[model samples]
Target: MVEIEKRNSILEVGAGGGYLLNHAMQRKKKNAQYIATDLTEAMIKVMCQRSNLEALKIFYAGINLFLLMKLKIL
Candidate 1:
């Protein structure tokens, strides 16, 4: 079983390959919808292609940094 991060670094900056997200999805503990929101468009495409999760429902969207500011996330 993959160890869950204490802080759950899902929204990390400069997360290029998305190793953490892919790792979590591989663990089929529950049937759940996973959302992969990234700051970079290239990362979004790469993760969707590399994840290769057959049974997982994934929603990958590239969120702009400006939008984050509007949402008061930053």
Candidate 2:
């Protein structure tokens, strides 16, 4: 588990490839949330595959507003 003094929620907009998002998730283990958004189904699939199940609350959406409205992209 990572122990960072200052932890903040991460809102990644247009997380197309998901590589950066995946890395960010791995870096911070506690009190950190990740929200990934993409405009294509194929991209979302790739993103899901990159994410680990152990993550706390990793959210995925087709657009930023989907997450903002508290709804799934699909």
Candidate 3:
């Protein structure tokens, strides 16, 4: 299991409908930030419809920029 800290920033790539992200957010600290990105606009729209995710920062991107940056490819 992943433990979220008070100042942690959580990013979820390919978050389809945000099922896992939503649950993870529940365990996050109040000051923690959650960002979810998906390849399709439909999935982002679906995530936006969830009341529990209203405060979530969502975006639509073709690829996982964070992963690429971690791998030093970006």
Candidate 4:
């Protein structure tokens, strides 16, 4: 397990059902900023509803991998 000394901004692309997102929230780092997004809308809905997840910040969006050469998230 990697210890997070400084909870920097995070962006999770292609986050499926947010299983990892739930785990990330458990850390509860004060400076943590989280963003979880998926390619499927249905999956995102289920994750938000069924998971009952809590985080500092969560973002949902569809990404086209072909168009994305490199992503710089801040």
Candidate 5:
């Protein structure tokens, strides 16, 4: 489990519909920043439509092979 503190910045990758992030936001400090990213526009749209997650910063992004190589994750 991740421990969130005040003023912390949370980044959730591949956050489809933001189910977990939404739940985490309920318990997180108000000053904390939550950012969610997903590869698919459909999932991002779904998260955007969720009224409970209006405070979240949503983006469309994906990790490609080039990034993996650059990060030495491949």
Candidate 6:
């Protein structure tokens, strides 16, 4: 079996909607802190509203650092 620490932290950048973080909270070990950061306050607000987990931390910063993502779409 895979052993895990009692405390954990997951930081998701450009975490729009926070779907992955939401699922991670359910599957990961206890005492894990989920931090979701997005490029806009709108996205973060929406994510916080959609999320039922009280431990989730939502933060926003206006930065687009996804060069690879833009290239992929182009």
Candidate 4 residue lDDT tens string, 1-74: 55543466556677776677656666636556666766566666666665654323334374332111111222
Candidate 4 segments exceeding 4 Å error: 1-5, 53-74
**Whole-model lDDT, model 1:** 0.42
Model 2 lDDT-worst window of ten:
65-74
Candidate 4, which ten residues in sequence have the lowest lDDT sum?
Answer: 65-74
Better of 3 and 6 by TM-score: 3
Q: What is the TM-score of each candidate against the true structure?
A: 0.44, 0.55, 0.63, 0.57, 0.62, 0.56
TM-score of 3: 0.63
Error of 3 at 60 (Å): 10
> What TM-score does prediction 5 earn?
0.62
lDDT of each: 0.42, 0.49, 0.55, 0.53, 0.54, 0.49
Q: Please give, for residues 1-74, the per-residue lDDT of candidate 6 as tens digits.
A: 22223436555677776666556555555655555566665666566667643322333384442210111111
Candidate 3 lDDT over 1-74, as tens digits, reads: 66765536777777777778657666777666666666666666676666333433333374422220111111
Clashes of 3: 0
Residue range 6-56, candidate 5, lDDT tens digits: 536677777777677556667666666666666665676677666333423
* Residue 33, candidate 3: alpha-carbon lDDT: 60
Ranking by lDDT: 3, 5, 4, 6, 2, 1
Off by over 4 Å in 1: 1-15, 53-74
Off by over 4 Å in 6: 1-7, 53-74
lDDT score of residue 51 within candidate 3: 32
True-structure lDDT of candidate 5: 0.54
